[model samples]
Target: MARATMDVMSSAPGDQAETPTTSASEREPTPAELAAQQGVPARGASHYAKGTSANMMRSMLVIVGIGLALFLVTARPNSVTPESVDVASAAQYRGGQAGQPFAYAEGLPDGWVATSVRYARSKGDVMVWNAGYTTPDAQYVSVQQAVDPGQDWVDTQTNQGRVIGRIETDDGTRWVQRDREGKVQRSLVHVPDDRTELTTLVTGTGSWEQLEEFAEHLTPAKVTKAGSSPSVSTSPAS
Candidate 1:
């Protein structure tokens, strides 16, 4: 029985271990295998191309938005206009009465609009009257009158201009012309033998001809009491 068992064991295969299997992480990948992987693109060229296309689209949208904003801002229209004023009525309300030693303008030409008028006590106890107007060409013109003012007052009014020449009006009144940088000033002094002296100045950004026209229309008047209400009898030019 022992001999039969030994013959059967010898006939069987020799005792050898099977080969061990390798894990996925420990194995190397081929180039074709990597190329077939999903969710990943090729390096450099394709990736930069997609990124550049997206950036260009965003930049174009921003440029279009800025252009639209500028057009809206510049094309808007103005909806309101400024109100006009009456100089004569304003002067009357500010103590311009008959027989007062003040200066005023009458028979102003067409297209001239008075914007302001004032009468106030100034330095050296002198009374000053001023009336501002907008000329036909939209330039600024003003008539300033002072009672017994100093030469310094005249200098200040003329912007320290030097006397250029003299102009004689139709009424035999002589006006002194002063040349200042960016302005023209014409002044006249009235010294009555029985009354106080008066100085009238026509100064403005208007042309010399416009200033002369303003000076020609000026007339001397007197201030009445304060708080006087006067009627305006003039109309604006068409």
Candidate 2:
């Protein structure tokens, strides 16, 4: 009986040891392990977080590009308006200081903006008066007056142009028009019969009609009761 019991116990232990036992390394692969083996990222919290960050970055860049496009479409910054300069005040100051019969435009219709004015001495001690204006049609026109000027000065002011023809004003006063090499500038010269008088010139890039209109409004400057105040001629120059 003792031998039988011992043999049974020994056999039971041998059977238990011989049966196949699963080790930690021999278990079935989990979902995450399967994904890693397949070269696929697991759908975890961290992975979803990275995907959301990438999406947000792309969305921000798209928004910024759209905003920039809208701004460019709305902003038209090419055509700039020229700032108007105060020609009257400058002309007044110059006339008062020069103490001569300075010429300036007066009683002009609207849209005539003076861009510049000056009364100063030029080469050879020649007293010069200049006033520039933007015409109603956005053309440039200027008045140039010099006292006892030489031929060289005349040539310089007229851009070394050749006398083409004559232009008559309302008062039958004749002006000599010069033709320049290019259409860049035109000149109407009023050469005083007496060399001692003021040689008035109307010149600019304006059309002949615009130049005539500017010349018609030319008047002699006068000092006001306030001595320094500038005054324009009541009537146009003859």
The CA lDDT at 202 in model 1 is 82
The digit string of per-residue lDDT tens for model 1 on 120-229 reads 66667767777778787887788877655877887877788787778877777778888775644444433234335566778877887888888888765545665566
C-alpha RMSD in Å of predicted model 1 compared with the true structure? 17.8
Best by lDDT: 2
Stretches of model 2 off by over 4 angstroms after superposition: 1-80, 223-227, 230-238
Q: Model 2 — which ten-residue stretch has the worst lDDT?
A: 229-238
Q: Where in model 1 is the C-alpha error above 4 Å?
A: 1-82, 93-101, 123-125, 182-195, 221-238
Model 2, position 180: C-alpha lDDT score:
80
* Overall local distance difference test of candidate 2: 0.75
- For 25-49, candidate 2 gives per-residue lDDT tens digits of 8999999999999999886675435
Error of 2 at 45 (Å): 20
